[model samples]
Target: MNSAFSYNFPALRGVQGGKEYFVVMVPLRLIPKIFLFDEEEIPPEHRSQRILNKSRVPDITNYMLENSKEYVFSSLTASIDGQIEFQSFSDNPNFKDLGNLIVSLDSKFLINDGQHRRAAIEEALKISPELGEETISVVFYHDYGLSNSQQIFADLNRHAVNTTSSIGILYDHRDQLAMLTKEIIAETPLLERYTDKERVSLSKNSPKLFALNHIFNTNQKLLGKKKGEFISEQEKTFLKDFWFSLIGSMTEWKQVLDKELNPRELRANFIVGHGVFLEAIGVVGNYLFYNYPSDWNKYIEKLSTIDWNRSNRKDWMGRAYGQTGRINKTNQTITLTANLIKRKLTLPLTEQEEEMENLLKQGV
Candidate 1:
């Protein structure tokens, strides 16, 4: 009865930078009502935070809608712009931080860092109202001023670094492509020794040949399945066979697996040892898999006939290496490299590849 007509939350108080802040678990249903978002045009310098990117909202909403039952959101940082009252349950110092926070209905609540999440939650609730029953934690700071709020937003984002793709794939259990990639690396005689599981870019002297996410992405191109899509045993067997036969045909990779060649030396000397080639192989393998299933291995065997030496400028200049002589990693380069590999393997190029090849010949 006491909670009516006002915003009341059971909160845990904490101190940061000598200022009191509170953490509260807010119900999704109350989110849109309690926090305010203004879409009206405001200059960036005057606003408390950057403008809401409307483009990012739908994707976030879809993710929440798809995984409403299991989705996780980190704590939203917000600023309460009114004098809110906090009542402690006990006078004991140990219990002083446990309290009820009450704010007048007229108080202004502004999100400092999670506007996208707030927007997504609102959209998700519209479609899956049951999701509104769940809660998201919000860390509330007493608003000093708009400048302070802007500073808070800056502080929150300034230190943020995105989780690396390789580590994310390594830790993901729900993503089928990641799982299959991990399984293949764990089991494959060639990849097991040379796969870097956590980092995307291998150090110049590192023994590892490729990163985990690169392998996962190559699998994505190889299988053309949605993220987290289920894999049939037959499909899994075919992928295993295809990759095994493909790698077996690469003599240098075998030499590395057999410790006859240093991984760094191979990565330095040939396009075959670069991760881009894995993607190119995946592209070529994907075309062969769906188009010429019975003869894919036969074509893959022809991989051995291609000279992969980085010095082969006629074959590799614009495809595997840039005009600057550095290895190329762009999607365009990967496609061009795949097209060259397809030709060497006596496989017909797809129309798209042929067009790209024509453009390459035209020096475009």
Candidate 2:
């Protein structure tokens, strides 16, 4: 007789590709005991799925523990390498479809996907034992062998794609900066109508000058704020005033607002229509606000006099545009453009800015 332990779980039986599977909800406390990672190093001859990344386990654990109240996870997928049996209580055919799934404890259950979540749940339970009461959905498939499990892993991840940053910002309400960016974009004159709502970068033929994420990042730089940092009402007001004043000083922006110039014409003719210039302007604004809070508006007049045309190679070639005639997004280019704005405004550079200037002087 085979020595075995058995677990009976309420399950729904389903079939796909002529194979049987079970969908079951298991309590968090039982996860560690039922599913094994088999995380040891394997030689090439015995290798199955890619080796588990132990480094990522702690981060995922912390995410689960921190967001325990609001956290949501998709179903965990696993495969069992033993016989499984199902029994139903009622005689009705519909009732027969819903039954208790009994799996031999002697069966080897290996996670084909969601090993990170499995690790995280084990870690989280160590500190927050009460979480054991919560349940997670699991999909169980009978395992054929190593090659089948490896194929399952490959098939699971083959089409996975991450959401775009602009779309993330557009939908995120948890981030204060993203929230403020949307409001600010809605209020800014030319920006309100011309900003791309769901992309990080715009195509040459795109009608918008800025992407939602670009505007959010530029505002973050402008206020010297880190991502997800809280913004005070005073800071919000200051940001609004700063952007309004800066836009007011740009003759081209005013022309577009007044319908005197087409947006495409401005985009084709100037570097200011790109994200690099906008972010550089934000960096300059950040410096001026920190150093000259009471008189920063005075420098807005000087911005109008600086040539912003993209064809002005002497001013833009090495700063905003590279030798290949495309926008260069390197930090060096942004700093160089900010330095040009500082020079135009006659503002003294900070020690860090001075170092950047010296680096550029050395042709680095």
TM-score of 2: 0.86
Per-residue CA lDDT of model 1 for 227-265, tens digit only, reads 768888867877889888988899888888888899899
TM-score of each: 0.93, 0.86
> Taking the tens digit of each residue's C-alpha lDDT, what string does model 2 give over 62-168?
77887889888889999988878877667798777688888887788898888888988999999999999999999998889988787788888899887788899
**CA lDDT of each prediction against the hidden true structure:** 0.86, 0.83
- Candidate 1 least-lDDT 10 residues: 1-10
Best by lDDT: 1
Q: What's the CA RMSD for each of the models?
A: 2.2, 3.1
Total clashing pairs in model 2: 0
What TM-score would you give candidate 1 relative to the actual structure? 0.93
Q: What C-alpha lDDT does candidate 2 achieve relative to the native structure?
A: 0.83
